[model samples]
Target: MTLRHAVLAALLDGDMSGYQLAKTFDVSVSNYWHALPQQLYGELTKLEKEGLITGRVVIQQGRPNKRLFSLADPGTETLTQFITEPSRPSFIRDDLLVKVRACEVGGHAELIEQLEERAVQARAKITLFDKLLRELRGGTDEETYLASNSRIGPYLTGLRGRAFETETLLWCEQSARVLRLRIGSKPANG
Candidate 1:
């Protein structure tokens, strides 16, 4: 999906300034889609120009005024249309994976180190997703939250992110171990 759809999805929570949107993306939306602050700002402007979203200036006492954006009626309609369309499957395009494929050519040690680091990063993301899951539940038990909350989409997506990261961590660890063993079995000069 385009960043436009992602922004619209994020605005579903509430109106927010560019800065607020960036923070939300970093914490929540980053789980599924990643975008830089500048990209978000640009998309905000484009969305406003397209009438997909509306922005209003909010004045602060000591800080510069900021424009808060919210999804417009047209934007909601657009999102609904997008939902009805079949989604394209996502594929991995990772550099590390490519390097791993070439591990037999040497640099296995470096690749293994990179994989370990990725595992650590994945674990950190899992922790963050767990915290978000708790916050989304709002002190309600999982069953109650699932039964009561009408807007469970974010929660479900968060769960997917958590699961994906957990699996990634496991894969990274396994890859590192295999690479290490292969390196150990190799001759010193070979």
Candidate 2:
């Protein structure tokens, strides 16, 4: 899907300034859609020009005036159309998988380090997701949250993120194990 669609869908929550949108994207939309803040700003302007979004300038005391953006009716219609239409297949272009695949063939010191870093980052994200889930469910207890499903979105997304992190950690651990074994079996000169 186009970045425009992602921006429009995000606006569905409510009007927000560019800065707020950036933060929201990092927390909520990062799982399925990834875009730089600069790209978001560019898309906002383009959407405004296309009459898909409207921005209202707000006066500020210290910093520059902020423009709060909201999805226009046309934008909502466009998003509905986009969602209904068959989506294009997702493309996979990831570095971590490639590094893991090559871990045993060559020097894996850097790759292993990077994998460790990714695992850390993934755990951090899972923690954040869990916090959001707790807030959504209104409690820390799993049974309580399960019984009350008022906030289903974050709960479901959090579970998905947690599962993804677990998978990533497992992959990293297995890669490290295999690489160490290979290193131990191979001769120093070989």
The candidate that achieves the highest TM-score relative to the unseen native structure: 1
Pairs of residues clashing in candidate 2: none
Model 1, 1-190: lDDT tens digits are 9999999999999899999999999988987799999999999999999999999999999999989999999999999999999999988888998998888898877788789899989999999999999999988987899899989988999999999999999999889888878777432223
Displacement of residue 104 (Cα, Å) in model 2 is 3.4
In model 1, pairs of residues that clash are none
Query: Measured by C-alpha RMSD in angstroms, how accurate is candidate 1?
Result: 3.6
Cα lDDT for residue 155, candidate 1: 92
Give one digit per residue, the lDDT tens place, for model 2 in 24-100: 78997777789999999999999999999999999999999989999999999999899799988866578888877
In candidate 2, what residue range of length 10 has the lowest lDDT sum?
181-190
Error of 1 at 167 (Å): 0.6
Q: Model 1: what TM-score?
A: 0.94
Cα lDDT for residue 126, candidate 1: 96
Predicted structure with the largest lDDT when compared to the true one: 1
